[model samples]
Target chain A: METTTLIPTGPPATRPRRSPARLVRAAAWIALAVLLAALPLYIDTAWLKAGQYMMIGAVGAIGLTLLTGQAGQLSLAHAFFLLVGATAYTVLAGPTDEERVIGLGLDPGLALMGAVLISALVGLAFAPVAGRLRGIYLGVASLSLVFLGLYFGQSLDSLTGGTSTGRTPATFELFGFPFSNGGPEIEVLGVPIRQAERIWYLFLVLTAIAFVLARGAVRGRVGRSWRAVRDNEAAATAMGVGVARAKAGAFAVSSAFAGLAGVMTVLWFDILKPDESEYGTYGINVSIAFLAMVIIGGLGSVPGAVVGALIVNGLPQALTLFSGDLGWFGETGGGGLTPILVSSFIYGAAIVVVVLFEPGGLAAIGRRLTGLFRARPREITREETS
Target chain B: MSAPTLREDLVELQVDSVTLAFGGLRALDDVSFTVEPGTVHALIGPNGAGKSSCFNVISGVYRATSGRVRFGDTELTGQRPHRLAKLGIGRAFQNTALSPHSTVLDNVMLGRHALTTGGFLSCGLRLPWTVRQERRHTERAVEICEFLGLGKVLHAPVAALSYGAAKRTDVARALAIEPTLLLLDEPAAGMNAVETAEMAATIRDLRDALGISILLVEHDMNLVMGIADRVTVLDFGKRIADGTPSEVQADPEVVKAYLGSGSEDA
Candidate 1:
């Protein structure tokens, strides 16, 4: 074999031109993030609670972004991790003095830590099988986890509170201060923030951390390997990437986030019940909701995950509020139908739009808009020079 | 052209008694050959001659039914592709295997994956050292891409590249690994005269600069004869002749199998 090696001539680096449109879009994103952070203070108590839910949902969605978006692995068992964490919290921290049902008699803070650790361990257990399977096979394997979780949640009465449902203990005290039900008030800029606001801030901090970590992952070497595997597995193998390990690691990371969300969910609601409906329980529907968030945001974009979570979560809440005032259906039926059915249809429709037209999701749209605006000045300058 | 004498004690890759059978049909029948290092080795034959099968076996894409493949002292018969890669064996497919959606830089960086150590968490966290490593890898990929005259399209998506450019990108990606043994499956199959000459020069440069052994599989006899140090001719899954380019080109069996009727046109 004659070995021919071509010396590559380096292309001259050119500075990217600035665009007003890109500036506007970036400003829009900054404005949105700022608005979201400040939203709790400006909104009503109901909407503030809903905003908190959306932020939590965004955190879970960011994890899904890593799994499905970057790694190109589909998972439908995210709710299983959520359930595990929530139940672990209740079981571990439930009334230390009461007649315990499979209770470990651990403190709430310790229980939360234990919940996260246990969920992470369980995620690792499923990683091997999940990693071995690809595309639809992986999807089916992960979906099975949800069924397994549901079975235990319903049948394991000692561990779970059973089908009857159970309340979590009030006052998850940290540093000798209560965090549940209007515990401590903090005055911020002459505005007194309630216990819920404090909890919201905690969730926000976690969400921010998740976003930064996910962003770094997507932009780094690991992210590149994932894209390579997703694009061409054979080539990736040829490049000496451990395809199975990369896929499995993505699943574990995604599951860890779900577990964290579960802990927060229990703290927010003061309950852990598996038999409750999709909205109430961390079930299959919640998994779908998370998937929708990723798809709408942009499959591989970190920022897209947050955008998607807000769209998918916020739209339904807004619609329900609208439906309640309009009285479209019966008083009791209107709120549920609008959020569940209509929001689902919208979610489904948004996914189709994303897949067909803008596969990059909201992130791609943002990039394009930026590029368009950035190129304007260059175009004008060229025209003038010519 | 002067006949370059073969080194009597060259540390060649030896394939001994390798047989590959697919169901009832045998693709390779007790095939055996030696590829000398620091020289171009050509594996050429008619269609269904098991040339590709031999390439596949040596590159760890296919396992031999009964044989031993030794690269220096290591047995590479049943190793996985990645393991083989780690052992310094790099392969470029006949079909361009570049990721169409990724940038040229990203595609080449895939080659350096084996060299990098940080796992998912390290990369995700953007550890100071990992970022520095990434910059160095990107620089290397750029250097390799520029070497292949693909620097102009470094940031461009592979999907936007022409067939010839894409093929060159594959070679660059394989070379980025800095392999001890490089396998090129018809690297000049679809290039024009200018591109072919450029490719030939690039191939020679690779050997001189990298000091890696090369295995070239090509149908273009003129191009093969121009650069190959030693050519092994195969017919019906058996080695018909093996010698210096001119010697193999003049062999009666090679003439009968490849250039019918021993014509002057050959």
Candidate 2:
């Protein structure tokens, strides 16, 4: 993750004076929100599911961006934390009467929150090692956690419900209202809203909250220290920013976000099966995919991460929607040209292009486009040696 | 606060007999010195004479093999660089370790980290208290920038700034820490004559107006001799001369080792 891009070029810390450009940006954001709100009405459940999946990607990518992009800590442990969150959610929310698995039988809402907290604590525990290691060393060390999670999921059947006959999570409910078809039937402007529609709203809210909080962190004093630490550890320490704590905190925060994504994943799938193979769902490839989102998004840009997630995660969902309509996949099944494979190839190319050409990724492009609309195209500074 | 004496202040940076070794090679050998408060103390030597190594030891970047450092009454031998900042020791690196992608103001704001106390939660949530704290720190950074004549490009990313501007920004950043003592390493190394004069003036003002003690490490004899109250010369990590600027300048040994024996006399 790079911290250099988060610097706000605007001055006056008390209140940034409003400009036409900022208004345009705000208006664009509002338009995006409106479009997201209206999508369920026009699009069927399958498309909505695809959209929901990308939102999940957005949530997880935001967290990764904070850790890997902003804090400059290379982490391949997002998948491990995701599994931890999912397992924690399942174990805590499973019914007390369930015979085969361990269950706390807690409130679904509390269980959801507990999942985030538990995963974050686990990440924090790993931080001592994470903090000590740098670059690929940290990445390899974090990779060990994914393997650890794999073992835990396989052996600890009481918590994760084993690899084969995975348990179903209790449907999440906020207070008396269940976020399911079982809840009181509701309609929106003559449109019949079902489980898929309801879950989309829940995910929407979670994604929005995640995005807002991340944006806040990126623009604040904490963000400054993260960038400082990323750019130069000595400089950061000299400025009184505890480098280790900041690194650890970045991991914890990112894990918490991934944990939320895990909870969302369980709710979406309606099942909690641990992947039997390392190449499957909760595996190293999943971690790589998440990292691809951050890199394509331009490391530390909060909004860029979301766009990266959309490109990486949204493609497969769209392919799934086209599966029935398009029988072209059957021909390439022998050649291993699955939707995921194709998406991987595309994103792989994206990463290479991003690195080779625009190192800032999509965020730099976005900045330049926005810069064009500025009132005074930032004064080209001169040395003026006298 | 107690009043300062002509030769002394309440606190002094005591660098007790310190030695640093990398296997068989000794980087520093029983080096001892003190930066007296409210005075300009210059540490000068030829390149690779362990002046930077001394700075690394003082700022806690490098652990000394056998030595004890004290910031007034506090033991600072094993203290972290961040902890040193809290203890009122500011340092400006020769290469200027600034976040080049960030704005000039943001880089300066980093220097205010020790003086301000807002954690991740408050800042991440944009809490009212944190906003207030952040504003106060920014205000102080702004003042530092203005004092250094770097107010014009506060919003410019450091990467976009000229070398002189960036150098000034680095110094302003150090000052933003509000240190009782400032350690400057080759601050005017690449500067033109005018910029060097400006830098010398700033160092003088810092000692005079802000009453901040300075430990200057520079190869520029003119700047060192003009501004220093006391000069300490090093030869191969061992202290060769420690005296007033004129006394050290006149010393035959100091000239032989550093000033090359006869520039002024010839």
Candidate 3:
């Protein structure tokens, strides 16, 4: 039984070969981090606010990517989870003085976490159906959640504050320090640290945490199972990956991320307004927008989602900011193309282009760029050795 | 429980009168066979002769319509695939089921998913415990890839591999699960003679060195006769012959089933 000849011939070592390109990538990441941290120092309050909005989109897009791109579940329930998160936070943290509405008066930070948990629970609740449905059917099925959110928002007036006049969310605070303007006044590089600047830093931290966690999950066993299920459920199951559990887990995790985005959303707007219809904030359009970010970013690419969010979500905010200076949207009523409208068109075109040119999205381009860089160094080393 | 070692104990499988049917057609009909411990067992037949359906029933991909499948003391007649895996069953597919964009290492590492505990939070948190466990599993995955002679392409996407390499990747992944019974569904389906010989050697190494019991379904007669210790032949979803390789090869029914009794007289 002892087959001496058949044992593995190569070195048993598993350590990845250290490459110069890897070092360059590490340095590039650090440079990107430093740039992000320094933005509040140079950028004005309005632009900082716009950046924060993009970060919210980044968080939502990352979650949507895990679901739609990685796990191969086409979901439009992002908006529903967002509403669930925002509503849960507001109902938990809103001041209880008003008679017409309901409030528990909890800490904002705790409320934020509660919102994520509740949204995840809502996703798990939908998982039985989610686990059964695949592809377009699942996408259409998830659309119902948006309608559910709309109806619940309008009818459950106490919690959601109806559609007309929304409820103001309590200022987000960590420990005893408010992420809002209510804390001790401070100065950073001769700039007064106000609400917008503070929110920018807060959003930066949240987005970083979300991004790091997502990257880790994507490269790990959890990610492996998701892709395995996406590729072949029978094979995955045969390898002891529970098909239903992986699907439900994706839904829950994706919802939790969307929930975090929702908390950020309410904090950014300083209010929680249930949509009057499925066309407003927290509607099908929002779901499509988040999906657009994931698709345009490249399916299953964590960093790609961020780029996608920048293009889809950042464009609108940037355009709105530039509107004062550039005067692009000069007229109000005669179909002159609003910032949001223009962004929508760009995003729609981006989705079409991504589907046509690169199904892998921006991530594939990023891979190709890195692949080129990696290949060049190898050739140079080979030439020198020869 | 810690994984059961092949050196310490041996487990045999029994398929007692397994029947699987869909609507009007019976894929497998009251067929029964046994695989003795630590042997290269082959399930072979002509097209649509219930070869894959039999493997599926045994591996729990398809529930036996009415029959018993016993792996040692465990009854796996109606069990799910994942549950069967815990009972030491790992299966590779005929179609080469591999994640197209994932690196071969990642695909192979997924085999140890059953062995790894905890979930997204444990991994996402990068908790010391989860990280350590993950590292151990990665080492195992690397070792498995090396054993399969695929160490160089560990980081390459599976989509870039040749037909034979991809099929070997499927086997490597199943091996990662450390199953007592490794089911290879047409491992040499798309391979040339040289690749088929290489696969046969790898399959034998898995049994002899790793002490894994193999159940192979193959269409290649030369490869099966060379590698398999025991051969089970099926015709029209019924067991036509089962015994030692030469014994089954010389069987009259299998001979007639294969070269056919002058075709036109059917």
DockQ of each: 0.42, 0.44, 0.48
Across B1-266, the per-residue lDDT of candidate 3 in tens digits comes to: 11223454558899999888898788888898888888889999999899999988888878888989999898988777788767778888889899988888899998988888777776777778877888877877777887887776777789988988999999989988878788999999988989989998888778877676889999999989988889999988889999888999899889989988977555
Q: How high is the TM-score of chain A in each model?
A: 0.83, 0.93, 0.94
- Ranking the candidates on TM-score from highest down gives 3, 2, 1
Using all chains and alpha carbons, the TM-scores for the candidates as numbered come to 0.87, 0.92, 0.94
Residue A350 in model 1: lDDT: 94
Encode model 3's per-residue lDDT on A1-386: one tens digit a residue. 11123234444445554667678879998999899888888988888988988999999999999998889999998998998999999999888888989999898888988998998998999999999999999999999999989999999999988888998888888887888777799998898888888888888988998888887788778988999999999999998999999999999999999999999999999988988778978999999999999999999999999999999889989988888888869565778988888889999999999999999999998888877756543323422332
Candidate 2 local lDDT, B1-266, one digit each (tens):
11132323237888898898889988888889888877889999998888999989999999999988888999889887689888878888899999999999999999877776666567777889877777777766776786777767877899999888898898888877777788898999899999899889988866765677889899899999999988888888888888898899888888789656555553
Residue pair clashes in candidate 2? A1-A68, A1-A69
* Model 2, position A123: C-alpha lDDT score: 86
Ranking by DockQ: 3, 2, 1
Please, what are the lDDT tens digits per residue for candidate 1 over residues A1-386? Answer: 21233343344322243656567768986996788668666766677667777887887888888888888898888888898888877778776565535677677678777777778778889988976788889888898888888888888877776768565543566665666456566666665677676677777877887787888877777887788777777777777877787777777788877887888887777667676444446778888888889988888778898889888887877777677687764444545454557787988999999999998889889878766655443323432332
Ranking by lDDT: 3, 2, 1
Question: Which of the two, 2 or 3, has more lDDT?
Answer: 3
- Candidate 2's TM-score: 0.92
lDDT of 2 at B42: 92
Q: 1 or 2, which is superior by DockQ?
A: 2
Q: After superposition, how far is residue B90 of candidate 3 from its true place, in Å?
A: 1.5
lDDT of 1 by residue, B58-142 (tens): 8877888888899988898877767766776777767878778777778888888787768666876789998887777676777
On DockQ, the candidate that comes out on top is 3
DockQ of 3: 0.48
At residue B261, give the lDDT of candidate 1. 72
